[model samples]
Target: MKKRFRILVTGSAGFIGHHLMLALQRAGHHTVGLDALNNYYDPKLKFRRLQEQGFNTEEIKYDTLLSNSTLHGSYFIQLDLADAPALQQLFKAQAFDIVINLAAQAGVRHSIDHPEQYVASNLVGFANILECCRRNRIKHLLFASSSSVYGLNQDIPFSTSHRTDEPISFYAATKKANEVMAHSYAHLYSLPITGLRFFTVYGPWGRPDMAYYIFSKAIVEGKPIRIFNYGDMLRDFTYVDDVVEGVMQLLDVKPATGKAPYKLYNIGNNQPEQLMEAVAILERLLQRKAKLDLHPIQPGDVRATFADVEDLALETGFKPQTSLREGLSKFIDWFKMYHKINEVHALQEG
Candidate 1:
């Protein structure tokens, strides 16, 4: 019989967190979701994700806990991690066994202009999480790190052992800081921590800020899509499902007891695809050619990103198996439905 424990997934309204919550519930684990639901993108999509969990968020207020009606033992709260007192109180009341901190101010370029957001959520918020986990005696803590930590790196496949000190963006700096901070906590408090360095995670219900999502919208709207780095970008583009799977498999696989009870692994497709190639796939799927607006690389953006997920595979007997075309196809399926932008091409008799 598989042992099921109560898991707290922050950013539960987020793309990957939402998927992971369902997966955990499927595995018979009690889940609690926490998201600020700020207008980072659109609260409508976030609330829609919550509703998928059977939550009625119309009257739901901040720092309030609401249980899901359909899914038993599932709950959600609109709370920010930076709210230290509230977070600590929740951890106390919930007595969570495992904590997955996926909530963070995401975006590489956005972080350049909005460093305070990153600091509040990624720095202060993360510190609050660590403190709570330590006091609550949580079994294991798994936090989402990003491939952005490998910023300005020429390494083809970014390994956990690779030098990560030279981050090019404020976002990357925050993530790198997270890894270091996690290591310190794990070392001191003996709290087991696993840092997941995720590659370009993409799929259905993905972040609208992502390039693929933007491409889909622009393709459907007959608008020009920005192709940064003059179409020379490369990314592993790991599917969200693959990332959720990796997290599930590693839920019970806690770090070692001795020394720093911490581990870091890259969760990626291991197959880097070109930026133009992804756009081409989107064009093929939407049945509309993308008007490319090639431009120089943006500040706080890398030319390429690839992951060395051997450690993840070695730890758990799995690696990302979703192909880029298949993943993009699935995303577009949801995109059309969500955005309601189905191709209305007419086949008039010629």
Candidate 2:
């Protein structure tokens, strides 16, 4: 029988974090979710995600546990990772069996403008997490890396073995730094750590800042949707469920003791989709037309991203399986409902 472990999922209000928290709860684990609930995009959306996980957003206070009514053995707290003392207290109190560090300032473009946010959250916050894990003697620590780390490689399918020193964006650089930092901790502290290099994950309750969500909104509102690199980008769009499944599977599979006690894998769909193709599918799903504003690729943007999931498959016996059309359809359905969009008006008026 599989052991029921106590787990901590940082960034629990975020997209992947929310889905992963629910999955862990369903698997009968005692789960504690923590999020700073920053205003990078919208705090309301983050609160909504917390609410979905049975947290009372109105009653939430920092460093306080909000028990879940619907899901037993689940709890949440609003806390910042940058607060070392608070984080230390939480780690001491919870003594989690596993820690999944998903808390970080996301978005390459946003990082270009707000480098300080990236440094504080991605670097400092992550350092705090590592310290806590080491102090608590956590059994396993799984953190989110990014496909962006493969910047300027020109490799068709980015592999864990490939060189990643030349990150094109500040965001990617921070993630790359995370990989090396975690490795150092693993080597020194003998902590079992795994870094998941996630591809373009999307689904219901995804971040509004993503290209698909933004394009969907603009298309429905009859506003112009900007296509970067003249719609000549490629992405390995992995679905949320698939990503969650991979994480769940790897939860029990910790790194070996002798091999630096650390490992990295690309959790992505092996298939890459063209940018225009994805937009077309979204248009079809929404039954709307998009005003294309073709432009050169913005700074900090990559021309393509394709994940080499061979290592992931070998390690976890899983790979992302959701097709782009199916995933986008689910996202569109959720988007309309979340935005309270009337289908008739959205299609005909736009």
Best candidate according to lDDT: 2
TM-scores for all predictions: 0.95, 0.95
Instruction: Give lDDT tens digits, candidate 2, residues 51-130.
Output: 89988878755444422223338888888999998888888877689999999999999998899999999999999999
State residue 64's C-alpha deviation in candidate 2, in Å.
Answer: 5.4
Whole-model lDDT values for every prediction: 0.87, 0.90
Tell me the alpha-carbon RMSD of every candidate. 3.8, 2.9
Worst 10 residues of 1 by lDDT: 63-72
Give model 1's clash tally. 0
User: In model 2, which runs have C-alpha deviations exceeding 4 angstroms?
Assistant: 61-72, 344-350
So what's the TM-score on candidate 2?
Answer: 0.95
Residue 90 local lDDT, model 1: 81
User: How far is 200's C-alpha from truth in model 1 (Å)?
Assistant: 0.4
